[model samples]
Target: MTEFNEKQIDILQVAERLFAEKGFDGTSIRDISKEAKINIAMISYYFGSKEKLLEALIFSRTADLKIQLENLRNEAIPPMEKIDRLIEFYVHRINKNKCIYQILHFEFSSQKRSVDFKAFTEVKKSNLLSLEKIITEGQDLGIFKKNIVIALIPPTILGTYFHFNMNRPYYEEIFDLKTEQDYDNYIKTDLTKHIQQTIKALLVYEN
Candidate 1:
């Protein structure tokens, strides 16, 4: 995440919430300025434009994840442990900031293309390549199955989380969740474990 001053952070936070609630197209710069209690010129001065602001928001949210993954590649830990940590990191982050998933889902599902989509795709590709390296290391050590398709792992982990997040409201309704904390607890515990186990199974299972 690019470091921002308090005011920039404030603007980004409000923008994220509005984007989650109203979506990118539905939201206006005026909406963000009003919600953030900042002048219109300030936002433009800080972020260039709404498109760049969205880009900054995505970078802010994902930069840490990218850093974490990069650090994992250098750690002396075993491959399985690295995988476990990766899963934990993603789950915990998503649990803390549900808006990241909301923005991703909205961007992917929208008919109109976002200028920042290409940047987002490049970020994903880099992360996936990093993951593939870890998986390949495991295969070399005969820990992960040789037949495992490295490309599929990222999508499997990400897709599962995204699917659950997009359908969270339905799940909450079905399960009769009365509070946000209740739902967060369920994701932090149950969903995290499920994804970890599923990924491990895919990596180590015999055909």
Candidate 2:
């Protein structure tokens, strides 16, 4: 992805937040301009259209994950460790970019697809394929069991996180979370461990 200028980045951030809060169809250039403190003409000048802007946002947000996956694939570490790190990376990324991830989750789940759905799915497919390659390598090395449903693996990880994220208020009470730092710590440590264990159980051979 090309480097985004400061204004472009600002617009993207505002757009992501609005799209997450108000659905892509609900948000307009005027809303973005109002929130971003910029003129609508500038958004047009930079991105041409709302669909193109969304496409850029999705690609830019996912570009690093793609590179990270590629790097992880070539690392000398054990495949299970790679999977663990991938899960950790995902948890951190989603937590950090909560709004963008929510927007992505909505885009994936919505029945009325957006114009940028193609770009979104492409990014999604690329990331899934990367994870699949790592899992396949593990199977080849006898580290993971064969006949695992590769398609289910991503949703298992993603859905779990989404459920926790979307129900944060309920979870806060259940977990007695009082502070922002407390919630972050809980998710990173306890929740992350649970996900790692679940995926390990699914992938590892049962004796």
Candidate 3:
């Protein structure tokens, strides 16, 4: 990932917020300029085009996670513990960067195949390969089940989290979540645990 100056970072952050609130097509470069408190030329000078700006935002957001995932292969911990850490890190990242995740989730759900999405696909592919390596390590150690569907692992985690997030109002009503703190606690504890257990159920060996 390229290092962004403070000005460029501001633009990317504003763009992320707008893209999450309004669909990418609904947001214009002018809209970003207004929200970012910068001139159109500055944005153009920093990012060239709306698509390139989005591509940069996605790369910047996922860069740290990619590094962490790559490092997991070298960790001395057992593969299952590494898996747990991965879930924890992913959940934390998604919560901390909700807007970017929301935009990516929307783009994926809409199946947009623009050139920008090609960048997203590459990022996802890299993350998936990192996960596959962890799973293979577990399988080699005889802790994880063989022939697991690696492709489904990400959707399992991401899809479940996205579904819960998108339906927050409904779930809050059903669960009597009265405060933002309550909902957040549910996410950090209950929701995170559920995802960890679900993934373990898929990967861990039986008996």
The number of the candidate with the highest lDDT is 3
RMSD of 3: 2.1
For model 3, the superposed segments whose C-alpha errors exceed 4 Å read 109-113, 205-207
| CA displacement after TM-score superposition, residue 104 of candidate 2 (Å) | 2.7
Q: Model 3, 65: alpha-carbon shift in Å?
A: 0.7
* Cα TM-score of candidate 3: 0.90
Best by TM-score: 3
State the lDDT of candidate 3 residue by residue for 163-182, as single tens digits.
Answer: 99989999999988999999
Residue-level error in angstroms, candidate 2, position 163: 1.2
Q: What is the C-alpha lDDT of each candidate?
A: 0.85, 0.86, 0.87
Order by TM-score, highest first = 3, 2, 1
lDDT tens readout by residue for model 2, 43-80? 99999999889888887787787778888888999999
Q: Which whole-number lDDT from 0 to 100 does residue 102 have in model 1?
A: 75
| Candidate 3 global CA lDDT score | 0.87
- Clash count, predicted structure 3: 0
| lDDT of model 1 at position 83 | 93
